[model samples]
Target chain A: MKIVLSATGPGFEAAVDERFGRCPYFLYIDSETLEIEATDNPGEKASGGAGIVAAQAVADKDVKAVLTGHIGPNAHEVLSKAGIKMFTDVTGKVREAVESFKSGNLKESTGPTVAGHFGKGPRV
Target chain B: MIISIASGKGGTGKTLVATSLALSLSENHRVQLLDCDVEEPNAHIFLKPIFDKRETASIPVPVVDEEKCTHCGECSRVCVYNALAVLKTAVMTFPELCHGCGACAYLCPEKAINEELRGIGVIEIGRSGSVDFVHGVLNVGEAMAPPVIRQVKKHIFSDGISIIDASPGTSCPVIEAVKGSDYCLLVTDPTPFGLNDLALAVEAVRSLQIPCGVIINRSDVNDSQIEAYCDRENIPMLMKIPLDIEIAKLYSRGIPLVLGISEWKDRFIDLFEDICACVKQEAI
Candidate 1:
């Protein structure tokens, strides 16, 4: 019933970050009640393997799904192996994305949305 | 003396200057030219050394013994590279992220981790005319390059002049190649990107306390800025090669500058002597 969305800040109104790894915070929201709890993403300051760190952190939290703008191959693999469903390219703020997911408007990702190290490049 | 040719920006003629200097120096002194770029080592294309010795370059990675592992999470917690992940049921190792520092295995309290050598590349040693040649070819899909660069530098001869051909950028690989050299020749153009990266390369070289000089390729393309930089920094402008269609044509044909235009031989020799002077001045 709990799902995680990569977010720029720690609230339902915070914008959903395009980058799954290196996103500042992850908002954990219970799908039914819409109650939210945010935790700092460990991968935000990691020197390397940001994707792996993020995915492992999510897996450890026992999140049932990940909703974000993009996901790299490493994070994709870790999440896939952990049996967590990924719904990427989900735009809008965290609350909107969760609402869309609840309404079955978001599509599930079958594979990685970007190449490895895609999140680490200059944001422009 | 060990002189390394490095350019902060790619295609600014690090290999060109390195091979020319090595070829010219070989005529008068024993010279060893090491292609330390490892990732895209093209000095061999110009030197054409028939490799007589080839050895695999490897680095040690941790191998966890699951039977003895207490799942204490020590190895994974200690890894700075994020190469290891310890789950409740299993411990995973991503060797590609490993820098081979042996920190994980060294810090494992349960003594469940052992080290194993993983081949990352191959080092080739050969001779091109009188110049001793050495280079490393990193394996495909391998992101690690410093290990292979280190392997190439291992072949440096103490009694002769060793010229290391460093890759572009002031990253770890460039530092690995330029470190511990008597003199570093930073090749660049007169453009903005060239000057920007040149400053970074100079900072890296200066941090190591190594004496360095600049070689401006296509010196006619842009001027006052690069020259002003040299003047302001008090770094000598050792050599200058103008932008010429003939030089470009010859380079396209894989011909060295010294070989394409015999007059350039003495120029490179002068460049070598200038480097020697700088090295001696630094020592004094």
Candidate 2:
């Protein structure tokens, strides 16, 4: 089985990003072999609907689950409809979150944690 | 001629200037006022139109037929706004993100998608004294304002003068309101924040290649750098309104300046004349 984690940096040692839609990096992992691959999130700089595009990209990857710090209603709906279980409120390093997921320590989120456009911070 | 009043900075008195100008000019011209600031439309509070006509404003959003959908992801691939998502067994639509471009339904491989009109707001049209009034009330939680703004602009008095009150900021909705105006009157303040946003508003207008002028509201409150910038840009400073407590008091009471102070009516008329002169010069 494969899973994806929204991360701030490239590897398992990196911290999990609080925003799933606009996270800079995504770490795709094979649950059994523990192999990891990191890539840029395609929806990172979307003008709008970052969650929609991010959800689409994840669904295309055929991932069984998603591990992230937070999820929005749009992304949550897409993930739920895709039948992909979402484990949220994740913190600390990606490796630790993965370990917790593998050990069945993480709780599946029933719904979105925040509102839309919550990831958009103050403009420069 | 169609003239739009805009300000990059909020609370710079765009509505105050718009309402006064529309009221003052209606005596001689068949003037129309469009409150294009759909999200927080306030001109209605001042004009208090009779609202003879009201209709729902909507945009086309896609609705998919699950039975016909093959879950091929074609509609998702064609949507640039990320309004659609196709999973293996299901498809999702985010109507708020949809621009209503109809690309999704047009490109759906199995012809499963159908376009539906989703209500975003309501457009109201009526009479206020001699002026024709139109404004849009955007539904709460709706992110799209351009469609509603466009609906209001459709009521423009083409034979006479049309004065549009646009929303603050240099965003898509502002562009939709200010586009195709014969002239743009940019209301701004003398403060630093005002000047910064005014520059952005100016860029937005210039990008559209529309001729614009500036109106300095509360001109005596701060440094005169905004004047300096206007001079540097060669954009005419059409009028100036000093920081007067009486004017603020009138505005707070929803009384337009021209109505509260009869003496100010001539000033607004003069301002309209100056705008006409500027538009004439640009035509040359």
Candidate 3:
């Protein structure tokens, strides 16, 4: 099974970004071989519905699960309907997060972890 | 004439100018006031129109007929808003994100899409004496305001002057409210933030090819750089209402300055006259 991790940078050593939709990069990690490929998140700069757009991107990659710090309501709905399991409230490095997932140490989120537009820029 | 009172920044007296102008004009001329700031409409707080007519505003969002849908993903591809998603076996529709552009239903090859109206807000119409008052109240959490603003504008009385109270900023809702007006009155202060937003609002108005004038609210509080900018742009500086503690107190009490000060009523009339002159000059 392949899992997508919202990352702060382009490698498995990079820290896991807390922002699911607006995170700068995402790591597509292969569960069996532990290979990692990173891609820029297009939804980072979206004016609205960033979560939904980000969910669509991950769903298109045919990932079985998403590992992120938070998933918004819209994104949760999309990924849930697509039959992709979400593991949220994830922290630390991408490599550690993947290891946690493999050992079932990470929590499987039943619903959205954060509200819409969470961690988007500085707060007013 | 349709005169839109717009501001680049919020709390710069767009409603103050619009309501006072409408009240002043209604003394001698037929006037209609449209509060197009659906997100946080406050014009009724001052105008206090006894709303007698209420109508709901809706947008037509696509509803997929699953029986006929082939899951081709065409509808999802055409939607710019990402409101539609075609999954393995079903199509998901997010009505809140939809702009109601009708591209999804129109381009569905399987002929399985139909539109259903989703209520976004309500338009309330009544009379504040002779001035017809119309305003839109957007449903809480509804991201779309332009649709409700358009619905409020539909009730505009063409035989009289229509003063549109536009929401702040140069975004979609502001554009929807200010576009197609005979003249746009941009409200601003003399601060840097005010100047920057004023420039944006001016550009938006000019891009729409509408004549625009400036109203410097709290003119005495800051430097005169806004005046310099207006002169450089060759846009008329219509009026300057200085910041006054009395005016602020009255506004806090939901009382229009024109109603509280009485003499300022004539000032608003002058403002309207200047707008007419600017519009006439542009016509020529």
Question: Which candidate leads the pack in TM-score?
Answer: 2
Can you write out model 1's per-residue Cα lDDT over B227-271, one digit (the tens) per residue?
899899998998899998999998888899999999999999888
DockQ scores of the candidates = 0.46, 0.83, 0.52
For residue B241, model 1's alpha carbon misses the true position, in angstroms, by 2.1
Candidate 2, B101-199: lDDT as tens digits? 899999888899999999999999999999999999999989899999999988887599999999999999999999999899999999889999999
Candidate 1's displacement at residue A13, Å, is 2.7
**Ten contiguous residues minimizing lDDT sum, candidate 2 chain B:** B219-228
Best-fitting candidate, measured by lDDT?
2
Which portions of model 1 show Cα errors greater than 4 Å? A30-35, A64-70, A80-114, A121-124
Question: TM per model?
Answer: 0.89, 0.93, 0.91
lDDT of 1 at B42: 97
**Candidate 3 CAPRI classification by DockQ:** medium
Q: Order the candidates by lDDT, highest first — what do you get? A: 2, 3, 1
- Candidate 1 vs candidate 2: the DockQ winner is 2
